[model samples]
Target: MKRSLIIANRLREVLLNGHWIANTNCKEQILSVNWMQATQKVGNLNMIAALTFHINYYLVGLLTAFETGKLEISDKFSFDLPPISSESEWNKMVTDFISNSEKFADKVEQMEDSLLDQPFIDEKYGTFLRNIEGVIEHSYYHLGQISLIKKLIMQDQS
Candidate 1:
């Protein structure tokens, strides 16, 4: 099988479906929480909604790079999630995340295997595969946080 296909599958495994890794995907976790629960803060940790925005922020930036050949994302702005005050607002954010996740995987799946080894946008940023894998690792890290936060929130409510 092609390397791109494998990478894309791995992406889907974390973000969309296929739960062999963490036993849960972003979509499932995000969907499990209501707007109030998603926006609730547990101590100093970020809320679920913010984490979702952070992951989707990178996904959107990478997807833009994939399409336009320019990587314009900055870490400083990655967590600048707009205030989500209502269920509709929260739902829209989740919907955008799911849509972007699908698009990101599709873009990867269509890539030529050779492109994976090439530097993404520039030589300093390393290979496309490295950045793609970073997304998966970063996502799982935050997914674990989300799960823990959800538990903490639930426990607090009880």
Candidate 2:
């Protein structure tokens, strides 16, 4: 019933579980692909592995800010996904993404509802709710791309 819980649920609906919106969450989509499928390039679009790393990058940075009260993430480096050359490496990245998603939701869930209105790191960045909601919207945008990319890759292979 609390606002924090509601926002956290939205985060889960997009990232972890709940199929009310897009019919697929990030966890389900990312987990559906193997290393080869994930790394497969489809024209000029970003690969699935790169997108996964991008989302996880923000999750990790936001979690860090939640813990330390400092926001230190940049858009330029968000897609700087390290080489995922092997299945084990891909799996490690997937594991970290899932772990960070849960941690991000948990941190948001535990916050006092009023905290959502407070500035995230500073007044220039807007409120906590704005950033969290931005993540959800941004994720869905990329999720749509991931879905399309996966379908394209599968079609190409067929």
Candidate 3:
């Protein structure tokens, strides 16, 4: 399988099915059976819901860049990503993120393997694959953070 396509598929499985977990935390650990209460943000730093949304945002952007040949990372940081401050807003954002990501990955899966190395100039990052790799690494890194933060949030609530 192509590296880009493999990464794309792996990421989807990770995001949705708990396959590429990248961290020690399990699915049950990150999610409360009652996910609604778990969506509440307890402090200035984004809670589990906001962090989850931010993860999906980067994935969506990465896949979009790959398909369109225009790479750009968002200005927002996980700590400051638009707050999932409300349950309704958080739900929509998370749901849309997931939907966009699945669509984006489908686009990536159609590309030739050699295309991954082809250059696309981004005003911020210089090349396409460089930016794509960043997205992959960043997603896994934040998945780690999400796992850790979710644990903390659950512990406090419990």
TM-score of each: 0.98, 0.98, 0.70
Off by over 4 Å in 2: none
Give the Cα-based TM-score of candidate 3 against the true structure.
Answer: 0.70
> What would the per-residue lDDT of candidate 2 be over residues 1-158, giving only the tens digit for each residue?
99999999999999999689999999999999999999998889999999999999999999999889998899999999888889999999999999999999999999999999999899999999999999999999999999999999989989
Residue 138 of candidate 3: its Cα lDDT?
65
lDDT of 3 by residue, 45-87 (tens): 5566656666666666666665566656656553455634456
Stronger candidate by lDDT (1 vs 2): 1
Candidate RMSDs in Å, in order, are 0.7, 0.7, 3.8
- Clashing pairs for model 2 are none
The stretch of ten residues in a row with the least summed lDDT in candidate 3 is 24-33
For model 3, what is the C-alpha lDDT against the true structure? 0.59
Candidate 3 regions exceeding 4 Å error are: 20-45, 63-86, 122-127
lDDT (C-alpha) at residue 108 in model 2 = 94
Give the best candidate by lDDT: 1
